[model samples]
Target: MTELEADCSRCVGLCCVVPAFGRSADFAIDKPARTPCPHLGGDHLCTIHEVLPERGFRGCTVYDCFGAGQFVVQDLFGGAAPSPAMFDAFEVVERLHELLWYLADARSRPEAAPLHDEVDGLRDRVSAAARSPHDVDVTVLQSRCGALLDEVSGLVRAGGPSLRHADLAGRDLREEDLYAADLRGAVLIGADLRGVDLGPADLLGADLRDARVAGADLSQALFLTRLQVRAAR
Candidate 1:
């Protein structure tokens, strides 16, 4: 797995226990916070991992903790038995790791060279926060990272369309030139994007559930997480 990808083998099923979810299109049952999912096994693995979607647990299939599960288990708890405190720290560290993922992606972009130093500094702060999550204000750190990411998007996109927060659900956008488009927070559920090249398009928080992406080129999309890709067809 990559640095930002979850490695469940190194975790203690924290995601299955820490967060709550209601019955919806994503999940088939209602689960309370801090309660283990019925499908979690004694070995810290999902019992229905091979057929989670077929078993009405599509949400779990798309969920990505950005490697926070393993980091918290190995680095924070030192492989000790998970505690309530560890569960609480899991969410905080996940957010920090997400910020780090974005910053690391920005730092790697040749177009964002001018801001690589800033990205590196912010990454260092986020890494520290991940180690000591209780002492850090995640909201402030998110705001700082968001501003820098927006600037990086502008530089890389040059003059792409500003469609942030646009509701384009079920729209057929195969002909749209989405190269470097600012699609932050766009509602793209079920949208048809077959064969479209989303080169460097900012997809932060974009909902891509059930979106048709057959033959779509997202190799260079900015801030596109694995969750979004999994949610798409």
Candidate 2:
């Protein structure tokens, strides 16, 4: 199995919490922060696993915690026991994943090319942390991921664009705009690109295993998964 798959299977649905959602195209109702979905069982598995999309849970279907949830739930807590500490830590993991996704998206732009090495280094560190057997300092990692994301956000808001070699492992880019973007030799394992506009995008030699791209428009995107395309909307 791919590393992403192995990592994802270890989660306990922490992504469902730590983020707020509204009754809209992507979700069915108003979901508050740190609250579990109505469809999630006590065991932390989605009750509507087979038909999450049809039930207005498309966002849930495309979300991936990259084993962060699993590691936190099983490795750190030794089970799915609920606790204030675990919830707090889960919040940080959620933020870290969000920042990682933002950085990954920025890396696809030309302006973030100079920071590709830094992004890769961060990915390696985070991946290692995800695989660790102990609990991590969520605050520290959140700060680290937040800083990079802030840097990229500043560049993007400033209209600076540059794309080259990048690394985007375990990032989340759900419903982001990536039209005609260049992502050569990038590592994009476990990213959520659902409904992304990838028209004319270049994805040569990019690793896209376990990426959730349910509604992504990849009409001219290069080297994507045939299985992903077949499975997506």
Q: What is the C-alpha lDDT of each candidate?
A: 0.92, 0.60
Off by over 4 Å in 2: 1-10, 94-232
Model 2, span 1-233: residue lDDT tens: 12223243456667666577999866888999778878777766778889977988766765555345765777667876667677776655544544454445555656567777877788667655654524667577757865775455444334322343566667777644566566655667677887778765655445666667677777655334333343343
lDDT of 1: 0.92
Pairs that collide in candidate 1 are none
Give Cα distance to truth, residue 115, candidate 1, Å. 0.4
What are the TM-scores, per candidate, against the unseen true structure? 0.98, 0.49
Best by lDDT: 1
lDDT of 1 by residue, 1-233 (tens): 27778989999999999999999987999999999999999999999999988989999999999999999999999998889999989989999888988898888789999999999899999998999989789999999999999999988888888899999999999999888899999999999999999888999999999999999999999888889999999
Candidate 2: worst-modelled 10 consecutive residues by lDDT: 1-10
